[model samples]
Target chain A: MSEKILIKGNEAIAEAAIAAGCRHFFGYPITPQSELAAYLARRMPKVGGVYLQAESEVAAINMVYGAAAAGVRCMTSSSSPGISLKSEGLSYLAGCDLPAVLINVQRGGPGLGGIQPSQADYFQATRGGGHGDYHIIVLAPGGVQEMYSYTRDAFDLADKHRMTVMVLTDGILGQMMEATATENGEQTADNRQEKPWAVGGVRGERARNIVNSLYLKPSELEATNLSRYEKYKQVEETEQKYDSYLLDDAEIVVAAYGASSRIAKNAIDEARSKGVKAGLLRPITLWPFPKKAFAAAAKKARAFVSVEMSMGQMIEDIELSIRCSRPVTLCNRVGGMVPDPAMICEAILNANKEATA
Target chain B: METRILIAGFGGQGILFMGKYLAYIGMSQDRQVSWLPSYGPEMRGGTAQCGVILSDTAIGSPLVEEPDILAAMNLPSFHAFEKSVKPGGTLYYDSAFVAAPGTRSDITYIAVSATQTAESNNLKGLANMVMAGALLKSLPGADGGVIETAMKKTVPERKREMFDANMKAVTLGRAL
Candidate 1:
């Protein structure tokens, strides 16, 4: 086993991507996530990888699209507003059925919001940020360790699914430092899979592969969308990931993800000490949404509380996950503010009260 | 045992570095530790602060809202965070900067002349280390050897020459 080292979350993500055999990185500098690009800039060249600081988020994502079409592991990262700038490239990548990793170390948003930690971009990440009948695999990392592990695994998930896989994290997780064990030394590229459909010269072995998103015919477009939806359906059935704590007999279930889930775990412990039967269901995969876990919790839970660093954006998904069988409450902080454990404990107490009432 | 520490000072005072050192100490002891800094515009010129949590079990909520230990390196930081320490908690401040100690009677306040000590020892820009030494003296399971080890690991290789001066500053604070 590798020895644990003290590292920041953003650096962890960058190193993990390198360990996962990603050789191409294109990104624009943005607050709360710039460290990721900076780390890559310093380290990527050492590994014979390309780390290009694009002119803008739009250009960075398109660069990712280009590299991904060549069957190379590639990625781009940005904050909330920068992510909005890359939405167009996201759609193009999805429409063309390319594999890529996108990292959104989120800050508060609508426009140019504050650069503090926030999960406000939940909707944008899980709802197919760009316009289309499509979905991207979104992994919400709760801490620095997940920031590393999820980023390493995301490359494989993207390649296997032939779609974009997003590591949707917040500023707190991005900036925080913790002790974690990562794969040491330079990584070998022995694990990369061959992509038969990539846009490279066939050398007369087969027809040339064309990577394009434009379907001139309506029927072809519909068929393409249908096939993509079928892939998404398979992902939904098997890719849901979550973590549960003290949940078997919980009456009040707290549903949270990313940074909010860490705070919620503390609140659950506080509530438990105060005689409130609270539990936590932390979603690791935001796109798949962990509906099965929530549905199981709803069987024994009387109420659900969504703790978020947004204005209750994930609450809608929780409601739909359980089919509204249980009343779900929103315990949130927004505009770059994070909810403390005391606030979440109070919310849990209130939910417990309503559950028993 | 779980201890939440909040360290605050002006930007470039090594406030975040002090917190990270404490986290490293925790890690050396095989404890779960987390260090989170206050980033963005406020860190440019305004007061800079960071939260460090060291616990025996899994740590939740890396944000230290009500710190069990508060280290204020400047007057503004002391004034800003004096009231946020939990009752019966500990507060350490640089007496050379903060003219007066906190008015709170519930918590113990340790006034260390961290800045003066650092300046006198020719270890300028290391008052944060002095304060860290003072904090280590109070923290359970953190001894001089542990701190020395942590310091050796925390300080970058390029700055190895300053190890002696940093140790001198830490020893002075521990003496206080």
Candidate 2:
């Protein structure tokens, strides 16, 4: 157990990464997420860790790939535009089956939109941000506490799956400050275990381990892709996580993730007070999509409203999860603006009206 | 019970710090607290504001569109946030810098010359603390002693001197 301290979300993520045995952090500074890099700069040195501010996001993520290939727990963080630059490296990491954590403290984007909170990176994160038929395990944390816990979970999951794990959070979650409890000391790294497949030249007996994504032969590439898909399926079976609130008799269920989910919870509570049976399904694991939870929730839900801090990205997933048995509506804000509880509550009311109408 | 407060002022006015202190006080009392600031290029001038939510239950959203209490330290902030305070909520503004306090019939408005008081008392940068003190006084459930103790933890060790000055400002503001 650790003492509770008031810390910012970005700083909490950095601290939790340290606790999770991550010693190398490479990142390029960007708006709404620079605090994460700054905190790592100050704390990594104190812990004798390597904290490098790379010249750009591309260089930083590649540095992460290099360190990860060396069998060390390494990470990189950036906002939307920066993460876009790191997409190539992220795809490479996924293809190489390298265990690394990438934190996306997201801001508004299609291009260089704005630097306020926005969950507009859903498709990019869940559907492989780079050019590949690959997927990164994306964890969406709704608050400061989840920011800490999810970051720590990211390391464990990355190592477990030998895949790139992303902590998908918006600018609000990154900048928000809250009371959080962190473990006292750092955990031991698992370099020795990773050494089996690590890129360090054959030590004595075992064959050399090559960490790369390039497959010259078509059959070899197909086999690699198939194996990755198999692992992703296994992940989908085991890693679905979500928080279900007031769903027992919920007629209208609001599906949301990360920051939008936080606001949706408030709307759910408000709607319930006014005799509206509104519930929430907050996806913690965005990549796994928590299909089972939604499948179960769909049994009781009459209508659904997908709340997001974007134009609407997760709504498609919600529609697919429920198989269009119930109508799925959208309640969203875009370009770095967060929707208020009142707006979301109205969306719930509209969903209910449509369901009854 | 929950208290959703908005503290707004210029960047140098310690608006973020004011929200932090309230959050720290809530944490000291073992309550759930969240403080979120508006950051980006818009933070050009000292035009910064933060939303602080202190709740007995889990806090759903850190964003408080309509705050139970709105504390403004400058005219821009006052003008920007006056209408956002909930009906029958409390609005506390620093009269030293803000020239006009809008007339809102539903909410109770308190205008304090916090900057002037801090200046007169030779406590130059304690204006935010004074406003914070007034905020604490308005909330009946908050404990002044807990806040003072939390202030010790929140203030950095190197800036130990400012803690005393802040406490002094808090004490004076509470009296107002």
Candidate 3:
């Protein structure tokens, strides 16, 4: 119950972070997401929050790690190249099991690609983005309303799992306008549950909380890895949320999530008009991957086309979910190019052709 | 019904705003909508573009590659997206900026002297609003009063002076 205003996704994320009781933000200026830093820079001062524009993405993420180790809600955001630079920090945070949020408002990738909106970073975000055997809880928000809602959830999930949470979005979603807010006034989220391991010398009678991943003994590292894997499994079972559209009696299902789902929906509409049964399995949470819902979808769906802006990142998960129960095809466009509804519809029709003929 | 529109211009021409207004109108008309802008090195003092999708159904993609409508405010925008306009779609361009238009046999091309008309209304920096006006008028299936109401809703409530200039801009733009 709050007043509505047309706010950009980037700005809404920043504000939501503030609302979620996050008091520290560290980032470098990057296009399509710079508004995130700009909003924090302007407001972080008044609320006693720490906002620092580091020398680079690497430096910014490390600052996030430093703040997170002290048991505070902290975040860092960057573009594709900058996210690559922060990969080292991301991996370290995962190893330490620190609760932090990272926003990747993605643009064209592989190198210093163009700054158009793209989901090319899907593999980078989902499949253990950094090095080693670890995963960050990634959330893909498709619109402005979800942008605000997901930011609050991202912060909460980071704390809940004691892991890094990423808001994986494209530049267009970051820059678009919409009218919705989770809370009326800022500083409204009452998330300051007392923790014994918070920084500041642990107060009077608190256990020393060590926030590092430097386990020398092989047995100790293996034990930690086992625990983390169990936790990740629990997350998969409990929190794999997604949205299904027109899938009850659909023949051709379009498996798309994130920004790509927007285009896929239009294509599905066009295809449905032409008597083709096309539906969408839009993943609200990207990391957990929503296996159960999609498994149920596969029982009814004949063929699923994994539509993406990249080659085939999420398709791997879709394939893994179905386990060859039905045909899985790919419809992708890369290099910062957004595929049109006509192209996607053509791909769906082609999938239909392959399914029947 | 869904309409995908692409508005393009050189930087600082309010191309993004044009798309935003369309999206606002779409929202007011109880339609699902998205307004996506070009952000990066390409938008900072160079050619800028924004995609607006207005649909009765849920919107999936924020960016449209082959737009149903092209509101090109300058020459580069028209030249770059003239071919990308869907067959039988509409192209609303600013005659003040584009001296020569491409020959497209399939689409309806409307060349309005937008910047000049904004100048006539004592609004020099409103070529984009004019383009929005022309788009609102010429777009085959858009709600008429929804856009005008959204235009009135554009300015912040505290800044009444900004309201007059924006209304003047929209009016001059509509005239074009």
Give the DockQ (2 decimals) of all models: 0.90, 0.87, 0.61
Point out the higher-scoring one by lDDT: 1 or 3.
1
True contacts kept of each: 0.87, 0.84, 0.76
lDDT of 1 by residue, B1-176 (tens): 89999999999998988888899899888899999999878777788999999999999889998999999998888998999999999999999888885798999999988999889888999999999988887788798578788877788657977877777777777888
Pairs in steric clash, model 2: B10-B46, B11-B46
Per-residue lDDT tens digits for candidate 3, residues A62-139, read 999888888888999988989999999999998988889999999887899877778899988987678899988889
What are the Cα lDDT values of the candidates? 0.91, 0.88, 0.83
Error of 1 at A215 (Å): 0.9
Among all windows of 10 consecutive residues in model 2 chain A, the one with the lowest summed lDDT is A185-194
For candidate 1, write residues A1-357 as lDDT tens digits: 278888899999999999899989997898999999999999999988999989989999999999999999999999999999999999999999999999999998778989998899999999989988889999998888889999999999999999999999989999999998898527545367789999876899999999999999999999999999999999999999999889888999999998888889989999999999999999999998999999999999999999998887899999999999999999998999889999999999999888788
Model 1, residue B48: what's the lDDT? 92
Docking class of 1: high
lDDT tens string, model 2, A272-326?
A: 9988999888899989999888888888889999998878799999888889888
User: In candidate 1 chain A, what residue range of length 10 has the lowest lDDT sum?
Assistant: A184-193
What's the distance in Å from true for residue A139, model 3? 1.1
List candidate 3 segments past 4 Å from native.
Answer: A185-187, A203-205, B66-68, B86-88, B99-107, B139-149
Q: Estimate each model's TM-score.
A: 0.98, 0.97, 0.91
RMSD of each: 1.2, 1.6, 2.6
lDDT of 2 at A252: 95
